[model samples]
Target: MQTWDVIVIGAGPVGENVAERVVASGLSAVIIEAELVGGECSYWACMPSKALLRSGHARRAAAHVRGTGVHEPTGPGAGPDVAEVLARRTSFTSGWDDSGQVEWLQGVGVDLIRGHGRLAGDRVVEVSTANGTDRLQARCAVVVCTGSDAHVPDALAAVSPWTSREATSVEEVPGRLAIVGGGVVGTEMATAYRDLGADVTMLVRGQVLAGQEPFAGELVTASLTERGVDVRAGVTVVSATRDGGPSTPVRLTCDDGQVVEADEVLVATGRRPRTDDLGLSIVGLTDGQWLDVDDTLRVQGAQWLYAVGDVNHRALLTHQGKYQARAAGDVIVARARGTEVLAGQWQRHAATADHRSVPQVVFTDPEVASVGLTAAVAREAGHAVRVVDYDLGAVAGAALHADGYGGRARMVVDTDRQVLLGVTFVGPDVAELLHAATVAVVGEVPIERLWHAVPAYPTISEVWLRLLETFGREG
Candidate 1:
């Protein structure tokens, strides 16, 4: 039996972070991964997807710089260089190789076992590698960072539709592409392929970016339509049929009696946690369900078993998962050392940020960045909330960013606590402005104290001052 202080299943970002934490704390750890060490974010989801979106967004921003004569011509010549963009995207993915990631793990003193890892029992993991099956024991903790797989409905799965992996890594852009969801992946992919010179259509069963503020969806939808994308919302795909050949087209019939034919269909509905084959039954746990964890990211009924990343179902975002992993690792180290630990909210060993201040950024034409709770959610949770809206175009920095800058900023305040409950920014290049909001929300900075933190006159961040002023006036 191979023994280690900790055993991490799935060497994705979350697993890597957890292993790093444990190893840095003077504990030995081993990472078992069936695929590439860098996992989905490095190869397909975040890196490649952002690579595909950045060029188009930058070019659009440059085009918006029309008033500044320093900018170049703004028409057909201003379009993105598709070949160059794809080459850069390939570079971002390291051509889909993970040698660098493996080297980094080795450098950090984390052992790597290439295989499928499953829970055999408490503190015991069974790894199936090419050589044979190996039983491993974790003296401290067995962390499950197995992540998630893109969900494809049975109806669409039978048609062999493309998920996020195919959409982010495709060599050639299809002449016509149909995206099956209006969520972040679907909307971002729609923008990417359309900018890449494909005839793209999005079939959304609900509003685009349904998680964000309503105006966010409206703005993105407008931007997409302006870019010649057919975004059909409130439309469900009843069935999908595709020819057996790779070059053949796919036919999708919607509930609205609409038939859409595309050279390729991309399904971006949701994700399913990778728990079914993890041998959870051996530990008195069910297979194929989202693992529930406490604030410390330890599985509800298991002391030494921890589930981080998307599998835990705390927050399915990569960054949020990393946060959980860090906390969980700290908790494990503390417990192993028999040290007194505080698992309270906002403590070093608790994932309080996951509950109260998770941040998310949607990289579309006009980006959307949000942190903390929305007004509706705050009110739903019975908090006395106040919402303030500000026009991005009114900000001097925004005017300098583009000719006709259009965007909105909103802040949800807790009337009782006098702190920011949430903040949402929607505009070009607004993703950079999100971290400040995240800090404010996470730290629970009081509204009165926020006023003392002055914003430089001409930056887009001045909108913060405006929002505060508006709230002051209303209050």
Candidate 2:
């Protein structure tokens, strides 16, 4: 039996952050991982997905500019060499290896156990390794950071549809790819495969990028259409089946009685917590359910148990998960040493941003970047809100960035407080403009004070100035 100050299940980015933070605060920590130490984002989701999309984005950006001798590929064998792109993507994942990640953990004084970990009881984790079973105990806390898994509906199960994992790590681009769902994953893979020369079709039950500002999805839909994707909105797949072997094409029958065939089908509908087999029943929590946590990330009714990251269902993005991990780790340290815990909103030991100021970027052709509440959400939250819109294409920097720059920017302000509640940008390279907006929203900077934070000339960031101008100086 081994013991540590903290035991973290799953060595993903979220787990790594928690373990590292706790160790740095004079506590011993150990991470137990069943797969790669770096988890989903490092190997399957974020790194590889972004790597696959970046080549296409660069190609399009260069093709849009007048000079630099870049042109759209003309022949059947033209466009980005798919082999090279996959190679680059693989490199980012270190060929799906986690040796470096393991080394980093060791360097930071965090021990690791290569196995499956489950809660045996309060602060007790039973790890099943190749050798045998070992019981490890945490003197302070046991944190669940197992993250999430892609969800494929039962109707599509027979078709063996690809999830985000398979899509990002695919070796070869399909001749035809059908994507169901128009959220971030579906839209991104559609862009990547289309740019790699696949005949892409998207069947979306509702608008793409549904939770974001409607205009963002509208613009992304337009861009995807112009780039030769067949986007069918308001379409639902009633059933899907593959007739033959793994190489066989998939047949999708839609609710509208439209049948679609594709060499590959990717279902990017949603995610569910990976908690079914973690022995939650031993701790009085249900299996296969999201673990509920307070602002400090402590599992409700369980003082020695904590759930961070996607397992808590509070902001599923990797960055947000890490943010929660930092707070959770620090607060655990404070509690263990009998020190003061600043648990107030926006305090050092609180994850307030998960509710009020989360920032997200979708790496599609015209990237979608947003932070904080949407205008509708702010109003629904009982805030008197004002929405300001600006034409991103008209911004001088946007015009200079690309010849046919086209996009939009929106700011949702709390009229009663005269502070920004949210900001959304939909355009090429607008992702670079998000942090400034995130700071403003998270800091709750007054509208008048923002006037002094001038943006540099002729950059996409100039949209900030334009947004403030549209909002006006007066109440």
Candidate 3:
């Protein structure tokens, strides 16, 4: 038996981070990846999707600056050829090959195996390679970091609906597009396709961009609506039809009994954890499709197995997965050192924010980024919630930079702790602004000190100061 200290399955962000950390901690580990070394986030979810949105964002930004000093032509760098943009994105994400990642793994002394590995028995993994079946033994632990897949609603069956993959990788723009769901994927797709010169309609279950701060959807709706996107809120997509030449049509019957249609349909409702074919059955875990993990990311009741990333149904963001991996790796290192001093405190590193502070970002022109609890959620959790908001129009930077200047910001404060319970930012380039709030909330930074961390003058971030002032008065 070729036994190792740790075996990490699914070499995505979470698994890669875990393996890297383990190597640094002086433990031998191997990363087995079935597909591309970087996994779905590189090719599908974050990298490519963000790249697609970047095209739209850049063009819109340039248009906003047309009459200003910092300005560019309204035309996309892709002018009549999105292949250039797609090719650039593909290259950036994959570096045109997986060899770079494999080399990195090797350089870090983490063994890289390109094969499908599944749990076969106790502390054993059966890797099905082209050569043959190679059973690898992990004397210490196995980490599962397989990510999630786009969930396709049953209402639109037997039709080739564009998931994030197709939307991000499309070679040609359709004449019109209909996006189902107003979540991150759907809204970004709506923005991306529309900027690519498609008439887009967004069908959302609740108000458009629902999970964001209360007034956020209003700003996003105004922006998308201005850009010729038919914004239908409080609606659900009933079904889809595909008697098509190039475009796949989807028809939506909303809650208000409104009917809408479009050239192509994108089902961007949400994602389901990838928990198939990797032999979960062998782990004595057969109840839920997803393998639940305790803190330290150990599989529930199975110390030898850990599940991270979307595989554990935790926070799906790439950064959160990396955090999980780091924690799991430390756990393995501590166990190998025979230091059982702190029994299970490190396990809190495993998807702790999966429930509490899972942040989300929708990269629309007036982007929406939120973390922690929404007002309703905080109230549901029984916190005496006080929400303070600011209109972007009031901030100097927002007013000057936004051309028309339409956006909103809201902070949900837990009155008891005087710390931010949740945050929402909706405006141009606000996605980057989320981290500041995320750190503040995650660190439980007292709101008083947070006031001193100054955002640049004449920059949109200065809205933070204005927002804090507003909160002070409201409270």
Candidate 4:
């Protein structure tokens, strides 16, 4: 019965950005959310997880320095106060409340429908609310920003293993926690729970941080091991059994007939699109499938429909999803107003970075920060590439930052173009060093020109200078 210029199916950061952008461009927008308006990143994934990890990072950083009077705890109990850390994590999520997010939505003049929204054909969204079902129409575009959900293997389903949602929002640290998968979520939770005084075991089917540079996994694996985490790589959980209810311990049987017992188990394997019940079949798209989108984020074969964020499977990170949202929103507006829709690569209305220049940071101890392509990827893309490596500890700033600082920096250069195609930094607090690398790679800054962008002395950022030095300006 009602209509808006745009209808966003989810109110996560990606949906919020798209709605905000469209509303700012003079299009009326409405967001339909079944849960918290702030979505997973705000309540469960990004904010709370980082909050849980930060205190541990600070504690370790202080302990590493000589005059701080802090030392590594002999046992987990000696680390950061668990109660205070959990409370702080809760505070970051506003105690899992979304009133502030709702207020912001209202302030921006975007309407909200609190319900489940599903496609019912072109430009029509049927929302199921507590009162009843209401059919709404979109005058301009229908954007699906439904995001994603954690994929739990069928074998582990009955055991009620924790996902990223449960892991980040847990009120109590388990006495013994077992984590499966060595990707970002698994590694991060392993780091956090270990620091929070839990006996942690990681059963990884592959190397940790496998998507990043191999050295990243090696360094993180070393750090976690030194910190008392039992990391078993190339190990798979064949089955899981929890005999009782929530209070029971979980028993995991591995492929090698080894059994691991834990107070809690977390599965961080992967994510799948949240399109199962969105009525996509009515619109000719399959349910529970990742939507395909063009560079402009328009759904393939559907002119008026757009899919952004994790739903499109292009850069599942929250920040990257927001980046795609911005482009999608602008392009939708342009098309609506009969203006120029700049769809060229790297244009104002294109999400080119999703393919060529995405940046990611894993907040484990000795954080992993990377942007653009890895060396292997660049070569596979058929670029004549040269990889430059530098010992981050050799940089004066890194040494000054922490005693016995250990880390590595790598830059993959396109030899034919003499520009950086990728940069990876694995070390303590190297996350802050990522943006400059992102700019250089995204801007396609030539190595010759980078020589003039001198890094200031005595900071982890000076790794840039060291990396360039290792690469040699002329070469």
Candidate 5:
């Protein structure tokens, strides 16, 4: 039996951040990982997917420029360098190696247990290792940062369709690919594979990017359609069949009685919190359900247990998970030291940001970035809200960015408080411009204060200025 001050059950980004924070506070910590130490985002979801998307974005950016360096259309309809894009993705993922991550873990003085870890009881964890089973105990905290797994439809799962893992890490692009879903994962993957020279079709059961501002979805759908992706909205896949293994083509029958054939099919339906086998029932909780946690990120029923990241279901994005992890770790350390933990919103030991300012970016061709509550949500929350819109294309910076630039910007303001409640940006290369909006929303900067923070000349950020002006003009 081995004992540590803290034990983290998953070594994904959120878990790593938790361990780092606890260890930095002078607590001994151990991270138990069954698979790669860096987890899904490092290799499959975030890194590789972004690597795959960047080349196409860069090519389009260059092609739009009138300079000599503009990418001349090559091949049929001027396609991207598929071979180079895949190779770059491989490089970004370090050929799927976790050695660098392991080395960093070691350097941070956080011990690692390479096995499957589950709660044996209160502070006890039983790990199943290749050598044998081992019982480990944590004196301070046992954090479940197990993250989530791709949620695939039972009908499609039977056909062994690709999830985000296979979609991002695929070695070869299929000639024809079908993506079933219109959310972030499905739309992003559709953009990536289609740009990688595959004939892509997307079957969306709901409106594309359903939860975001409608225009965000509309713009993404327009771009995907203009790029030759067959996007079928309001269509659900009733069944899918593939018998000849992974290489075999998958035939999907939709609810609308439409049959689509593809060399490969990817199901990006949703995600399920990974809490089924973590022995949650032993802790007086239901199995296979998202863990409920307080503002301090401590499990509601169990005082010593904490659940962060997707497991808590607060926000599923990687950065938001990391944000939660930081607060959770600090709370654990404060309790261990017998210090009073701050419970105020946005305090050091509270995950207030998860509620009010969770920012997200979808890395499609025309990127989508949003933070805080939309106008509909703000109104639903009982806020007297005013909305503002700006044409990103009309901004001097956007026009200078590319020929025939197009995009839209929106802001939802709390009229009673004179502060921003939400902001959304949809356009080319807008991913980099999200932080400014995030700060505005999170800081709750008043509309009057915002007017003085002048945007530099001819920049897409000028859209911020335009949005504020629009709000004033409307008022």
Candidate 6:
């Protein structure tokens, strides 16, 4: 058995962050990864999905431009090249090599181990690779950033539904796709497949795809419908059975007793922690695991152990995981030096405050970007809040972006603090508008200060001014 200063398992965003910070602290570290060094988000989750979404957005723009009297068509779907779009997205996400990322780790002075790693005991890791089984103990710490697995609904558990793994790396797009769970994954995949020429149908338990914000569900559904996607909302899959050809046809009975069939079924329900086979029990965890962490991203009782990203079940976004990783890395250094790690320092130093101020963008046409709390959440959290919501129709910028540039943007403010508690923007190019709100929220800037920030005239950013005015706070 060989002992190292630190061993980080799962070389994803979080693990990379942890390793990066640890090496910067002059601490020796090793990263063990069984699959791609960049992990799911790089190849599939965020990068690929966003790439796919960008293609769809381009396609929609082309469609709009065709009838425009002023402009000519350009971009991905300039003349309907689905093949080109898929190929472009595939290449962008893969980036041609895992070796490049591994090289980056080497550049930072971190040892890279290509293998599967599990905790054999506290500060001890058992590795399984082509080289063979070896026991490696960490002289300083063991970190887990294993991430999560795409969820397969129990209704189609035995039917072998397609998980995100298959959806991401399919040799060819399905002729017809039926997706379960209208969350971000499902809707983003819908944008992917629908643009790539698949007959797509999304069955959602809720009214729309992750439509937690006001009028959001209706807006997304409208866009998908415009793109020829069938969105059946408030419909639960009562039964799922595979039948017919070698690939099999999926039969779904809806809650309202409507029957539907599709060539392929995709389970985009959610993701579960990738802790199943990992031997975490030695650290007081079950065969299947949960995120064991305190305020500083430290695994509850394990002095030198930490878990981040999807494994923590906090934000689950790649950015959030990286944030958690940064905290865990700092915490490791602090503990080694006998310095105390404060919980309040979470967001200031790292992404530890994901639950408090996390920004998520749903890359759909007329995109969805939200950060911090929602109006309901702010109220529930006992904040005396003022909610200001504005329609894009009311803004000159939205009207100029495109005809019928209908959208909604909302700001939730803690009236007492006169600061934004949350912000939601659902519309075209609204994705870019999120950072402004995120900065306001994170900086705890007062509404008066925000008004002084001022948006450029005749631009979408002007919506910020309109929203603030709606709340009775204006320059």
How many steric overlaps are in each model, in order? 0, 0, 2, 0, 1, 0
Q: Candidates' TM-scores?
A: 0.97, 0.98, 0.90, 0.99, 0.98, 0.93
> Which residue pairs collide in model 3, if any?
295-347, 296-347
lDDT by residue for model 2 over 360-475, one digit each (tens)?
99999899999999998888899999999999999999899999899999999998899999999999998988999999999999999999998889788888888888888534
In model 1, how large is the Cα lDDT of residue 399? 93
lDDT of 3 at 399: 71
Q: List the residue pairs that clash in candidate 5.
A: 397-458
Local distance difference test, each candidate: 0.91, 0.94, 0.78, 0.93, 0.91, 0.80
Model 6 agreement with the true structure over 369-466: per-residue lDDT tens digits: 99898888888899998888889767887777766677898888898988999899888778888888888888889878887987888998898888
| Model 5 TM-score relative to the real fold | 0.98
- What is the clash count of model 6? 0
Q: Between candidates 2 and 5, name the one with more favorable lDDT.
A: 2
Worst 10 residues of 2 by lDDT: 72-81
Model 4 gets an lDDT of 0.93
- After superposition of all CA atoms, the RMSD between model 1 and the true structure is 1.6
In model 1, where is the ten-residue run with the lowest total lDDT?
Answer: 68-77
Candidate 4 residue runs with Cα over 4 Å from true position:
none
Give me the runs in candidate 3 sitting further than 4 Å from their true place. Answer: 66-81, 244-263, 340-351
TM-score of predicted model 3? 0.90
* Tens digit per residue, CA lDDT, model 4, 1-475: 8999999999999999999999998999999999999999999899999999999999989998999999978853798999999999999999988999999999999999999999997899999999999999999999999999999999899998899999998988889999999999999999999989999999999899999999999999999999899999998899999888878999999999999999999999999999989887866889999999999999898889999999999899999999999999999999999999899988999999999799999999999999999998898899999999999999899989999999999999999999999999999998888999999999999998999998888788888887888788546
Worst lDDT run of 10 residues, candidate 5, spans 68-77
Q: Put down candidate 1 lDDT per residue, 278-397, tens digits, no spaces.
A: 988876789899999889888888888999999988888999999888898998999999997879878899999888699999998789999999888899999998899999989999
